[model samples]
Target: MNSLRAILLGTLAAGLSAGGALADGVVNIYTYRQPALIQPVLDAFTKETGINTEVLFLDKGLEERILAEGQNSPADVIMTVDIARLTSAKAKGITQPLNDETVNKNISAEYRDPDGHWFGLTKRARVIYASKDRVKDTSITYADLADPKWKGKICMRSGQHDYNLGLFGSAIAHWGPEKTEEWMKGLKDNLAHKPDGGDRPQAKSIAAGECDIAIGNTYYVGLMRTNEKEPEEKEWGNAINVLFPTFENGLTHVNISGAALAKDAPHKEDAIKLIQFLSSDEAQRIYAEKNFEYPVENGLEPSEMVKSFGELKADTLPLADIASHRKEASEMVDRVGLDDGPST
Candidate 1:
C-alpha cells in the first residue's frame, strides 16, 4: 500500500510539473476522503457547470505533499474529514480564506472556520452504541459514562485516534482540562478491553458480548446497517441502538467533513465554484443520501436511515474552539493511560 501510494504521488508530482495546473475548465483536488465517496458529487458538478475535475486521493500526508510541491502543486481544493485536519491545514499555511458569501450562507457559522479558511460540508455526531438486548436506556450523557455502573462494560478505539481526540477536545471545552482529565480517568477505568480498532469493531464487540456499550460515530451505524456487501457487518449494525450522548449543555457533540481552497490554487475560480456547488441544495442532498451524513446546509434532511437515529441537538461550540484544545486532550489521554485500558 505504501509503495502504491508513493508511485501515485510520484506520478502526480511529475504530471503537475509537466503541465502545471489543467486548463481553464478544469480544477484539481487533493482529498483525504476516498474518491468513490465524493465522486457522485463531483460528477454532478461536472454535469451542471461543464467544469471538469481531477482528483488525487491520499489517506495521509495531504498537507505535506502540497507543501512539498510548493507553488506548483496541482491541488485546487483540499477535502478531508475532521475539524482537526481542517484547522491543521490552515495552521500549516496550505489553505487560504474562502470568504465566499454563498459558502457562508450555506454553512452555519459554528461549522465553518471563523476566518473563512474552511467550510464544513456535512456533520456526524460522536454517539454511543449500546447493545440492543443488554441495554435499554435511550438517553445517556457523556458524564454518565464515568459512573462505576459501567465499569468493565465499555469499549472504544485508541485514545489518540482523531475521532476520540475530537470528542476529548470537546470534553475539555465543556469541563475544563482538570475535570475532563478526571472524567477520562474514570471512563478509562470502565474499559472492557484495551482500546483498539476503529468504531465498527467497537460495535462488533458489543454484539459479541465483549462489552455492553461503545463509543462510535453516528454514520458508522448507518453504514453498517445498510452494507449489503458484508452480512456480518449488518449483524454488527443490528446489534446496537444509537444513543445521543450530550454534555451538561444539553447539546450533542458533532464533527464535520469539510473542504478548503488550496493556498496556491492555479484554478481558483473553478475551485471556488465547485465548493459553492457542494453547499447547494442539490449537492447537499446527494451528500446526505450517499454518505448518510447530516447536511451542513440548513433545511436539508439526512437520509431516512440516519433519521431513524433520532434528533441530534449538536452543541453550538465552535469546532475551532475544539481544535484549539486537541493537544491538551491528547496529553490528557496519555496522562491517564486511557489506551492501556483498565488493567493499567
Candidate 2:
C-alpha cells in the first residue's frame, strides 16, 4: 500500500512539474474502483467517443492525493464504489459541481447530489444472506436484525466498515440517534463471531456453518458465483438465498457506485462528456451488467443474476441524508464495540 502511495505521489509530482496540460482528447481518471470492472466501459467510451482515457487506480487516499497536488492535479474524474467516498470528495472540495440535463434526466434525484457534485452510476442493496437449509424465513426487515431470537446466529463484517456505516447512517436518518444506538447494541450482541473480512466472507462463514444469516451487498453473491478461480466460492454462493430487508417506514437500504468531476480538471469538456455518457442508458447497461449491480437510470434494470434475488424496493431517503449521518454511525460502531462481537 505504501509503495502504491509513493508511486501515485511521484506521478502527481511529475504532473506538477510538467504544467498539467494532459493533452487534448484525453481524460485522466483517478478511481478507487478496480480497473478490471470498469475497463470494458472505458474501452467502449473511447471507441464510441474518440476520447482516450488514462486511469490511475488507487486503493486509498484519492482525495488526499488530489489535495496534495492542488491546482496542478490532472484528474478529470473521480470514480468510487460508495456514497461516503463520493461525499468525502465533495466535502474535501476537490470535485466540481456539474449541471447537465443529460445527467439530471438519467439519474434519480435520490442518487444525485443536489449541488451536482456527484452522481451515482449504479445501486446495490444491503441485503441479507440466509442459509439455504438452516434458515427458512422468507420475509425479513432491517429492524428485525435487533430481535433477540436471532442472537448468536448472525455474521457480519466490521460495523466500522464503510458499507455497514452507510446502513447505520440510514438507520440514524430514519430512526433517530437513540434508537439507532440501541439497535446497534442489539445487533452487535447477536454476532456469531468478531466481525472480520469483507462481505463475501460472511457468506463463506454461513457455508462453514458459523452463522445462519449474514449481511452483505447483492453483488458479492454474484462475484462469488462467477469466481472461476475459486470454485469453492460457487458452493458458498449456492448455499445462501438473498433477502432484501426493509425499514418500517421506508424501503430497503441501498448504496451506490458513483463518480464526480475533478475540481481542477484540465479537460473539462471531455470530462462532462464522459460523465454524461456514463449516465446514458447504453453506458449504464454496460456498467451495471459488468458487476451485477442495478443501473441508476430509471426504466433500466439489473442483470439477470441480480434480478434472480427478487426485486428491491430502494428506500427513498436521499443519499445526502445518509451521507450526512455517517459520522454518528461510525462513532456508534465504536461506542457499541460492534466489531468485538458479543462478550463471552
Candidate 3:
C-alpha cells in the first residue's frame, strides 16, 4: 500500500508541476466518476458561479491518493459512485462534514449522511432485466430470484463485485446475515452459468437466450439503448424488459453517485459552493439528462428514457445503513460460494 501510494503521489506531482499552481478561484476535485460523465455539470458550474474547477479522475484508490497527499492534497471535493465508496471516503478520514442548508434542503435525509459527511447526487435502481419472450411474470422480488422455479434461469456478474455487494448489503440490512446467507446460497443455486462479465453482458446473454432474467443497474439499459457506436448493444437493450424489483418492505433497492467535501481542502469556500451547486435543480437536471440517473433532489424527473422504466419507489432505508453491511455482505458471498456458481 505504501509503495502504491508513493507511485500515485509521484505521478500526480509530476502532472501538477507541468500544469503549474491552481488559482485561488478554482476548486480541485478528485473523483471516481469518468470525466465525461461529470463535465457538463462542471462546465455549467463555472458558467454560473465563475469559479474555475479542475478534475482528477481515478478508476480506483481515490481515498488513498488523497491520503497520500495529506494536508497538502489539492483535492477540495470528492465525487464518486455508490453509497459504499462515498461512505468509505468518509471512513478513511479524507472527507469533512458538509452542512450547507441549501444542500440539506435539496437532498432528502435518506440520501444524505446523518452527520453530513457525504451527499447523494443521483440514484440508480438494482433492477431485474427479464427476457420479454421467456419470462411471463411482470413483477418479482429480490427473494424470488432464489426460487427453484427459476433454476438455471438467471445470470449475473461476479457476486462480490461492488454493485452486487451493494444489493446484497441491502439484503443483509433488511433480512440479517443468516437469512441473507440462505438467500445468497439459493440464488447461487439458480445461476444459469458461472457468474461472469459486466452488467451489459448479462443483457447480451439474455438476448442470446443464456438466461431468462439478470440483475443490473437501471442506467445500463439507457446506455446500451442509446449506443450508436455499438449497434449490437441497442439490440441487447431491446431484448429485455426492465423490472423494478422490491424488497419485502415494498421498495426498490437503489444506490447513489454522490459527493463529499474533502478534508484539508485548500479552497473550502469554493468547494462548498460547488457542492451546493451540485444539489441545485440545474445540476440535478443535468445529471438526470446526461447520466440517465434519478436526481437526488425532489420533484426532478429522470431522463425520458429512464422514465419509461416506470416509477421507482426507492427504499426509504438510509444508504448509510446499507453501507454498514457491505463488509458482511461480501463475507457472506464467499461463505456461500456464490461466485463459484451453482453446485452440480
In every candidate, how many clashes are there? 0, 0, 0
lDDT of each: 0.90, 0.89, 0.90
**In model 2, which regions exceed 4 Å deviation?**
1-21
Task: Write down the RMSD of all candidates, one decimal each.
Answer: 3.3, 3.3, 2.2
Q: Per-residue lDDT for 233 in model 1?
A: 98
C-alpha RMSD (angstroms) for model 2: 3.3
User: How many pairs of residues in model 1 come into backbone collision?
Assistant: 0
lDDT of 2 by residue, 95-194 (tens): 9899999899889899999899999998899999999999999978998898998999999998988999999999999899999999888898888999
TM-score of each: 0.94, 0.94, 0.95
lDDT of 1 by residue, 145-194 (tens): 99999999999999999999999999999999989988999999999989
Best candidate (score: TM-score)? 3
C-alpha lDDT of residue 76 in model 3: 90
Off by over 4 Å in 1: 1-10, 13-21
